[model samples]
Target: MAATLDWKLVVDTHDAPALADFWAAALGYEVEDNSALIDRLMTAGQLPEAAVAEHNGTRIFRGFAAVRHPDDPYDEETGIGRGRRILFQDVPEPKTAKNRLHLDVHAGPDAREATVARLESLGATRVEEVNKGPAGHWWVMRDPEGNEFCVA
Candidate 1:
């Protein structure tokens, strides 16, 4: 038998919470609410106030924030998701090149344009439109942090 391991995709960003918020809205995911865990850690003196920040009326790790599928199970004590999720971590440097990996959002051909427009309204920018005639159509887009993704 094979063992199953849990995992999440992490993205480097200048602002972790903001990026998390953007992704959550974009994917209809929920931002993990770790305030209770944060408070407990603070009371235990295991985490410093300097290592936390207030975002969207909640306290989150200073350089880390995450979003997960709304229907997924999570650890209530830690606010860690147990299913599909994405973590945004703050980094000192800006993105200087194309992403080695990217996300492809499937909205079907009929909804592609509207989906791209909605993503744009949520701070994503269109990089280019790719059309292969009868083959397919997609829009290469960039998130607020310049990470690339495709809407098809």
Candidate 2:
């Protein structure tokens, strides 16, 4: 109908690279690199070399990068991307409230609670724990930026 929605999630953060790194490790996603494209741009004098920066052996736009589930589509050569991803973009302002949109991660069995604890160990904090209607239970937590996410 609507061209079959291409993606299912978007997570925003003030520190895109650090946020991307956190999510990448937390969600088992691989950090993406666009070094080749940057390289091409720099070589053609279309972009300054300073615009490209390297991190963890991957080249990307300076001050910005992203990560995605490893099995998801990602181009090795150009770093143009596809599949599940979280693009970290640079932004100003410390997050000051619950996010209007938040991620609800699935943790198996008593795992939801355990996941909450784990996320807390990783700098996330519990905001609330509550049961949704039948067959649903979740714990709200804030990311490092105070943006909220849920584990259920």
Candidate 3:
């Protein structure tokens, strides 16, 4: 039997390492370390020596990496992580349409505009805005990879 289902959201990125860093700051998450896995794979000859890369003193997988909130439960030594995580995976093609699942940021309404501006400065762009009568207003924005996420 399974204890629970763990969910991690992954976004396609061109630079998984840099994006992991950016999201670490933006979301107060810690980047996961994959060195042990890499080492084991290398020892088994499953991964080529050149397939692993390092950035900012962290061992990186060739096309994917993840970050989690620092306080989230993580293995003390290995730092193979869990909780409120986002993984960045490299994909050759650009994002061409809407995201099947998107994040809705729920900061207070008064903070929306400033938050939008801040995210814009962080490489996210406001793509659409919608308002409906009394309790409706949101800005649909695209991240650097063109994935849609909303701020409401």
Best candidate, TM-score:
1
| 91 Cα displacement, candidate 1 (Å) | 0.6
Quality of model 1 by C-alpha lDDT: 0.93
* lDDT of candidate 3 over 1-152, digit per residue (tens): 54434568878888888777766765557889888888878889998978998888866788888998676677655566655678899889877777899878766699999888888877888899988859889999877667788888
Residue by residue across 1-152, what tens digits does model 1's lDDT show? Answer: 44334579999999999999899988899999999999999999999999999997899999999999887789999999988889999999999999999999999988999999999999999999999999889999999989999999
* Whole-model lDDT per candidate: 0.93, 0.74, 0.79
Q: Write down the TM-score of every candidate.
A: 0.94, 0.81, 0.80
Which of candidates 1 and 3 reaches a greater TM-score? 1
Measured by TM-score, how close is model 1 to the native structure? 0.94
Better of 1 and 2 by TM-score: 1
Q: Once superposed on the true structure, which residue ranges of model 3 sit more than 4 Å away at CA?
A: 1-5, 36-46
Candidate 1's displacement at residue 100, Å, is 0.2
lDDT of 2 by residue, 1-152 (tens): 23322463655567677777767766777877777888888889998877777777877787687777776666777775667767777766666665687788889657877787877877788888888678888888877667777888
**Top of the candidates by lDDT:** 1
Q: Least lDDT summed over 10 consecutive residues: which range in candidate 2?
A: 1-10
